[model samples]
Target: MDRLIVMKTFVTVAKSSSFSAAARELAISGSLVSRHVADLERQVGVRLVNRTARSVSLTDAGTRYADFARRILSEIDEEDTALSESRDRPEGTLSVICPKWIGTLDLGDAIAAFVKAHPLITMRFELGGMSDRNYDFLERGYDVAFHTRDLRDSNVLVRRVSELPFVLVAAADYVRRHGAPTTTAELAEHQCILHPNDPVWRLGAGAETSHHKVQHPSVVANSYLVIEKLVEQGAGIALIPRRPAVERLASGDLVEVLPQHQPPARALYAVHGPGGHTPERVRIFLDFMTVWFRSRPAAHAA
Candidate 1:
């Protein structure tokens, strides 16, 4: 078997996690796909995939090899493109991944506008589907990943894109009925809405900061947008990202609780594999996103 072909096939199988799916993607037979993987495994003298009757998953060796293979293949493709055309202009496909909530808001608009402006670059914006595992995007064929929290990985270049400020808000009707919580300590007694990741709401800045463990949550949700809706209907108090909550707060559909307690703005980051060999399109896209987000109305607390 050709080494390049085997490498490509193995990478496809690793990504799809199924022989049949990889075959379909490659427009080949499942047995042929299996043979390529087996040949590659024999060449490497390691079992790349741990195959069972029901499922196929990469082994520890397979996991590391997949990363190398993806980078090698990507570099090869880039070189091929470079040889045929001038590498001065950014071209080729750039894949990005972000959380589902960001995709539905202004972030989505920013991405769309970016793609529209960069006609040469093909955009593959994957909305959500990030696993709980660390830096899963690298093995999953993504060029870049966006995250709100600071990533601890040393292998990737992390850039602070923008500040995602959030406000703890509730509906006027609910505030009237439940009475407002005047301080962070008082929030413990109120019917708070919990963000699955941020169960403990940290409020205020610097030395004045306080952490309030969400107590008596009437609802728990993963999406901030969904939390905003629940808060609007007088469900419970929620900490909502300012961009999505601005209009509602302005219209009085929601009222900020304890406006004095300004929570530190959540840092939104653009993270990707180490920058040295990173493709030009990926770099440009990240820069574009940062500038676009910075221009938007920030800190929507009135």
Candidate 2:
């Protein structure tokens, strides 16, 4: 007996709960389905199912065996499909995860374009709750992830895809009401709008980098989108990524403060699992991202 066929028969029987129904689905006679189940039970040395005059139900042991069988069958199917995909064409689900701030601000257009270009690839781009732990994506079953922070892990492959320049900005009203700071130290004296991840703002460039704690933040949130809104509403001053705020900055709704003391550009990296036979989907996406970002103006991002 082919073990895989037997397992599939057993799984079908377990799902349908009746041999006749299983046989109908598998395009076989009910007796064959029964024989398959009996063979599986005999091989396992356990009574796999309990039968009544009118109905059939799985026993305790049968329930466990059915679950195991389903998992084995699923894994086999996936492996077979993956092998086929490698020989044929790029077609599979590509799961991605990214920080919500980046997703909303800068990554949206690229995602749209990737999806549009690759009709064979189904994308599941989940935003928010990305882990700080290295290779957490492997555990979470993600194909790729976008990260901005400096990673210490050498185990995961990272490609620097883009750089985002951050600007210190506040509404004209906020600046008028609260006055602008000439130095980083004065930010402590003013109410700041801060993201929880980088609440301690690192101001200035290179050796001039000075950390200013959000001593008295009028608004505190984990999202840059929200923090930027608060700043635009004249709630407080904030260091926000400039791309999203460009229109407001031009309209004079927001103004760049401390222009000489700009923060370091945030590095956006495309992260994936360590060396292996990289999947065609992953390979294609990385290439697409590299091209997409390379075409983007660095001065605008910087």
Candidate 3:
């Protein structure tokens, strides 16, 4: 089998996690798919797939190789598209991945505008969990990712889109019942809703920084939306991004606590995989999003 065909087969099988499914998608026989994968594994001198009667899973090495294979295939597609399309018109699928809460709010509007402007280009938007790492985007064929955390990956291009302000807030009822904290020390007395990753809240005022480990949380969750909902229902206090909590805060459903001390703002980044050539469509979309975010009231305030 050709190396390219073998690579494609391996990638398909890895993605679908079943040789039969890959074969069906590729219009090839299951045995042929298996043989191609086996040949590729033998040539590479590594076991790519762990096969069982019930299911199949990729080995650690297989997962890494799959990432490489997908990139290679994407590059090939880009090259073919560039050679075929006119320079004036940019067209192709632009897949993006972003945290659920952010995507559900303003990011969705950004994408909608991009699509409206460039009807020739298609898009795939994935709403992922908060803790999802950058590599997961590359592995899943995402051309771009909207991430709030600082990333250390040199393989991707990271561009700052905007700074997001995080504020500690609670339901007005909860604040009235439990009494709003006037100082950092008072935070310990409140039934805080904790972000699992940020167990120790970092409260900042001017040049001063204070870290407090929340002793007891009425609710702890990985999702910002969940935390906001809990806080809105007066279940507990939570730290949330300004955009998601804005409506609640305005409606008095949630009130800012210790307004003088806020959590350090996090920068939102637009990240792309390493390919010497980034698509013109991808570039345009990213640029538009950056400008759109900057013009937004929430980002401007931050």
Q: Pick the candidate with the highest lDDT.
A: 2
C-alpha-based local distance difference test score of model 2: 0.86
lDDT for 48 in candidate 1 is 94
Query: For residues 131-161, what per-residue lDDT tens digits would candidate 3 score against the true structure?
Result: 3566777877888988888888887889898
Go through the candidates in order and give the C-alpha RMSD of each one to the true structure.
16.6, 11.6, 16.7
Please report, in order, the local distance difference test score of every candidate based on alpha carbons. 0.85, 0.86, 0.84
Encode model 2's per-residue lDDT on 1-302: one tens digit a residue.
77788889999989999999999999999999989988888789999899887889999999999999999999989999978776346678899999898898768888899999999999999998788786998789998889898776887888888887789999999999989999987888887887887778877877888888887788889788888888888988898888888888888899888887888778998899877577788888888888887787557543
Model 2: runs farther than 4 Å from truth? 1-84, 152-154
| CA error at residue 47 for candidate 2, angstroms | 33
Model 1 misplacement above 4 A:
1-88, 132-134, 300-302
Cα-based TM-score, every candidate? 0.69, 0.70, 0.67
Candidate 2: lDDT of 294? 72
* By TM-score: ranked, best first: 2, 1, 3
